[model samples]
Target: MEIITSGRLKNTIKYLRALFIIGLILSIFFMLGILGVLAYAKSQGAPPLAVPQTSLFYASDGSIIEESHRGQKRYWVPLSEMSPTIIDATISIEDRNFYRHNGFDYKRIAGAAIADIKAMAKVQGASTITQQYARNLFLEHDKTWSRKITEALYTVRLEINYSKKEILEGYLNTIYYGHGAYGIEAASKYYFGKSANELSLAESSMLAGIPKGPSRYSPYENLEKAKSRQKIILNSMVSNGYITKKEAEEVYQTNLAFFKSEDLGRERIAPYFQDAVKKELLTQTNIDEKTIEMGGLRVYTTLDPKLQKVAEEQVAKNVNPDSEIQLGFVAMDQYTGEVKALIGGRNYEESPFNRVTQAERQPGSTFKPFLYYAALENGFTPSTELRSEVTTFLYDDGNSKYTPHNFNNYYANGTITLAQALALSDNVFAVKTHVFIGENSLVNMAKKLGVTSDLVNVPSLALGTSTVRVIDMVNAYGVIGNGGQKITPVFIKKVVDHKGDVIYEAEQSKEQVLDPNLAFVTTHMMTGIFDAKLNDYTRVTGQTITNSLTRQYAGKTGSTKTDSWMIGYSPQLVAGIWTGYDRDERITLTAEKQYAKKIWADFMEEAHTGRNVTAFKPTEGVIGVYVNPDNGKLATNACPISRLTYYVKGTEPTEYCMDHVDHYEEVEEKQPEEDPDKDKGWFKKIFDWF
Candidate 1:
């Protein structure tokens, strides 16, 4: 019996020894496999840890205008700024053992692995706070073995590089909270219109329940589902001892007030200006779209909030609310080209099309100034006379014939000066002047003044037939307002990075595109529109637009069958207003409803309230001369009527009035030999002594 027992014991010992050897070999292989994975992770390099940040836009007065973001809206806040309730609730639900684990929960991972193996797919996620942070920062939320391995690798890096508080903070800030919100602060403000530090226990639990399935648990989307998740979170908080059972019960029963979904839509202020800034940033800088959206840039813009408010209010008050007629308003600094105020449409919520910079409509008579300016530059004075009779322009080898006349077919048939032609907005005179200077010259002049739209070089262009944008028209008129210095409109003044360093600063660009004398002469002619007793069509019909603002300003009124424009400027401010329908339909202006002029006058009057009235300065080489109103020539006392007209020194009419030769025949002509100063005028001789 003893020998049999010994044989059994020997067999048991042999089996035990063989089992020990096999276990040792398996352990060695596992260790080597882990070592290989660690080495591979080390060689693969660390994942990107830079967090996406929200960018802010500010007005000139340093007031926040808007906040912009890319794929996810995140407002990073330090852990101290977070309420203890939110931190506790998040920890209770996401990772109760977060403080004790190195980087992951191995027990939970094992359980999850077993469950996933049984299901033959990933059925559960055992990611701790640190692991989730790693995934949110660097990895994607994809369920795959390769993705899991990558997430695990990043998890170790995060724990090693950051502290426990930092890991928790990052996890809370980077987690998705739906509704375009990604962080605790953004979610708090989005859901409750308050800060995270002010969240109550109920609110914290409700917010904490969103990270698991934001869309499914969002109160805005599904109240019952969100309430159910909130209950689960409250129960977890109670189990973890973060809150008492009674407290949890009371908090769950507490009525939670939520922010309206429309509040998010209202967050965007001045949507049109915001869109313009975004486009300009992308086009003018080396920064890419992704960088601008997510790089946490602080953009200081040139928008004047006060002026913008006045513009919006004035437009709403003046335009017909029920009519489909749309209005485009743009105001800017004439010299610097800083856009002070802009209103692209009546209601940005209903329509997002920016008419200020996008829509192209004919300027009608408003374009006459550009033609006359071109003529002035090419040796024509303000007193240059042209016949205002009906004229036919044959273009394209006579394939097209354009018969031009004044507005309402009001023909002046006789001769008219350039100033009268512009004041009357005579199409026939404009066509004659356009033909005299050639079509390409006028187009080039408009281009230099900042008209970028397509301009057909036709005779009708003299009557503002070419389509142009309101912004371009405003900038173009600014050339005349700014004393001939070309200025391009600028929206963003500077762009700063998250570190408070200026990445981009606007350099004011100015070009001497036109002679200062020619600009002054053109401005002087434009002032004729305000002359109430000038007997022109605008005045004779009592459409005298500028009678409201009795200040010394220059402007022009334009109209087409479908569009109405009133663009004017003082020495300090330049504003343009356009009223028209989105579709090309006729807009009949009534006696009381002069939409464009009223809006322009209202906005300009408000804009110039506290500002000084500075007169347009005339440059050197320009002299004021009293000329015959009947015929554009040097006026004498014998002439029935005469007015002070400005002209370039050499371009003024040299000859005396010949139409009234009978009246002037009594006075002998002074020969050059008899009078040494015969060529100079009486005013010129008086100035020569000085």
Candidate 2:
């Protein structure tokens, strides 16, 4: 019995010594681990923290317009923007020692190791919030030793360099929460159908349970399992002192109306405009595709939702769907050069081609305004006469003889004032003016008015034979509508980067390129198209639609065999539309020919609704005069018809209409018919008295 006892004592001593050695080795390893972490943290630099996120587009009214992103559904919100409940719940469930730990929780690790040993399988995890974040950011979710060691390294570096709040924010923003949702904000929105800031305690607890096992805990997939997990989350919250035990119980019992819907899955608004903004982002910033998709840029645009809706409505209502005629429309604030509305085609979905800024169609007679403005610049008054007869113009040193015909081959066959010709849309008169002023005059004027399309130095160019973009035409019209100020269409007002920093902003400026007086006169000249008073041999081009007009608008209608264009403007807005077949098919239907004027009239009248009805205000350097439409001279009472004309301060016609004056004088000067009989004196006088 004594020998047995002695042997047992020795064995027990050996056992205790083994334990002591093991303990000492563990202590040494722990110290080395700490020192290794310190050394590694000192050596490792921070990696980029930014992840790809959605870029948001906003309208002028601060309403969300679009969301652009790559496939991932991530949105970065700062810690301040996140709800406190979410922060607390996440910390309570993810890493209780999130604030106190250097990188890992040794106590938690030991507990998990015991748990795994008791289970005889890897059934538990001991990852801290920082460890999980590091794994998510830099390593894959493999149980391999290499991945675990790498995760450990990253966690130490993160804890050493980044603040706790930043680390928590990044983890919350990037962690997957099922249903394609990444981050707490997205998950909150997905499950609760509300922003993270708006989530209730129950909703917060419900979402906090998702990141652990998305497919299993997602309310959308298995509400029972999700509710089961919610109890655990609330219990954890109670344990972490985030909530009282009773509060946790109450939250667990509360029924939640889960809204597992996503905004990213909804139909887009203003699809074409979104595309345009995206394009502008691509070219304007010159950034890579990955950045654009993930840049989280906030783009503020000049899109006026009301006006855009109206523009879309007018085009859809006016266009014939079966006719296969495509259309492009643009509306801009003439004063500010803001493109308020746009349509690339009859249907953007059918064809993605943007005719507004892409397709170049012949301007036809709408090009007359630019020519007339050029004439005004070159000392041509509104009363300047051009023969409306079909005439051939010889240019290129008389080597080029071009004979242009009027609309329907009809002409005044007599000289007509510029205003009269404009009203008639007399093509012969326009070409003649184009030739008289030199072709470069029109080209230069068009450039001044913002026509970027190629305009060749040819006589037909006068009659708008040159093809120009609808947007460019509208922009040029903005110049006239803004009283001769240089203008260009501005799509984006401001752009903010992923960090909410201003990256780009459109510069606002106006340069007066045309004499304000001449521009006013030019605008006045366009008004003739709607006036029947200026009709000579032909009715005013806008005569058919004049009854629909509510306010004074200046614009011209141009029709080629294929294309129909109406470009008009007021002080408030300038818009242009083009309607025709894609192949330039001749518009044989009468309805097709009338589309421009009708649409223009309706759009302008509706767009101008509720606004102050004011005529195009003239500058001080201009004066108005009543002139004879036929003779282009100052009008007198004897004249049967006169038009209120505008001209530069001293450019008004000096001579009065002598034809009417002379006729009136001749009638008054003629002696009475009975003068001869009266000379028979007393006898005739007595007979007359009887």
Candidate 3:
């Protein structure tokens, strides 16, 4: 019995020694932890923390298109602008003790811990409004202990530095309410279209409910769920002494009055122009954000809303399913180079291909105008003669010879004047003229006219064998309208940031592309193609063309084997149109007209409706003249019936063709009766004259 007692005492001593050793090790560990915390706290107190920078995008009209943070739509407003109802509702739902508690609400945290421990699942939340705001602004949404610790630290710091009002305002502005919205101002605009000051009690409650789960309570996402969540927020507001019970019940019974902003998330009519404008914005502003997240941006663009709508409607009406041809078009104010309209494709949903700015297709015979202009610039008058016969161009000694053909197989073997060649779009005539003018000179002429493509100096290029875009073509046509001055197309007029600062402005300038005399000669030649007196129909074939032409205007038509094209201009406007398969297939050909002319006609008609009907002022360098049809020179009685044409001052023909040089004479002009003297006069009608 004495030995057993001794062993028990020895065992007790051993146990006490082990406990002392363990306690010493734990104390050392605790000291190390405290030292580490003190060192970290000291380091943090002396430096500013690095945070992520946000990028922004703007429209041509200077509206914001996007901001950098995902699911964040912050439109910062001063605390003075915030509504009292919104303030109360937010505080009641987020944290009623926000005014009294420091960032770390020890009582709330202990209560949450107790509840979580009882439930055996992590289902409790202890974050105050200030804590949540700090986390949202500076910390990532991580469900880890380390992230929570950082959130608590930042919240404490924020409270120490800022007033309650400032902290509340920050909380209201930085919290997410879903649907890519961030701040109270943006949320108010998203759901109500107005400022936060305009929110009603019901609306405020509904917005307050969204912070917990945006998708679950979004009015656009689910109205029933949103209403349910709103009730919860109202009840919480009443319980937290934010509002009386009677007031809470009254507001809860009221349905939310939603405000939908017209400009906030809507797409523009001409997406191609918008896309081009956006790309320019990125290059100029160094903005790298995607377009979807851009809030309400007031984009002051160059697009004429009226013309763009007409172009869209025309494509929808004319591009039938059988043809499957898509259409692209662009219009611009000729004087200022402002783009009026742009249509990227038939529909943006089926394909987002921007045919107007990106697609490269052959210009076809429309290219003839440039070739003709090149000849005129190089001292060739309208009366310059060339044969319209089949001729073989040299390619290689062993290969089949290259022979250009006219649209119609028949041709005149004798000499044809330059005016006649252009009016008929004769392939052989243009190719021969290009050969004489030098390929480089012709290409330079095209480039001067605003053609942006890399053009090769090949024989086929005379017939527009080179590819070009609709925007470039429209601007090229504007060169003629500006009296030989070339202007770069302008889509964005100005870009202003959210703070109302103009960050960028469009640079508009014009440079002379050709001698005014040469441009006039080209314009004069084009006038013949659309002469009302020349067509069997006494009136113009298209109302768009007729209405746009009170004075001198110039334009040309083009058709590759598959696609059809038109680019033209008045003194005020330049427009281009193209119709072809999106996949580059031979779907539109022979007899049936494609969407090209229809879209062009429709867009122009609408664009010119309210605009001033003005004529192009004839420049001092040009002159009008009457000439015989058989020759581009002075007419004689022996010459066939004649029509009038114009020419540049020193470029008129000296004499008629040899066949009719001495046989014709000029005729005197005649005047019409001043009035119809019929019995339909007022006084005569009273007398019933028969």
Per lDDT, the best of the predicted structures is 2
Q: Give the local distance difference test score of model 3.
A: 0.72
lDDT digits (tens) for residues 360-459 of candidate 2: 9998998998898888888899899877787877888989899998777888888899888887888888888887888899999888888898878888
**Model 2, runs deviating above 4 Å:** 1-44, 260-265, 662-690
Best by TM-score: 2
Per-residue lDDT of model 1, residues 434-455, tens digit only:
9898889889988998999999
Cα lDDT over the full model 2: 0.84
**Model 3, stretches more than 4 Å misplaced?**
1-129, 156-170, 178-181, 189-198, 212-253, 258-285, 289-301, 394-401, 494-503, 532-553, 582-584, 591-594, 628-630, 634-645, 652-690
The lDDT, on a scale of 0 to 1, for candidate 1 is 0.83
Candidate 1 weakest ten by summed lDDT: 533-542
Instruction: TM-score each candidate.
Output: 0.72, 0.89, 0.72
lDDT of each: 0.83, 0.84, 0.72
lDDT: worst 10-residue window of model 3: 46-55
Q: Is candidate 1 or candidate 2 better by lDDT?
A: 2
Candidate no. 3 TM-score: 0.72
- Candidate 3's residue-wise lDDT over 212-287, tens digit each? 8888888888989988888888888888887888888898788666766644567644667767776766776564
* Backbone collisions counted per model: 0, 1, 13
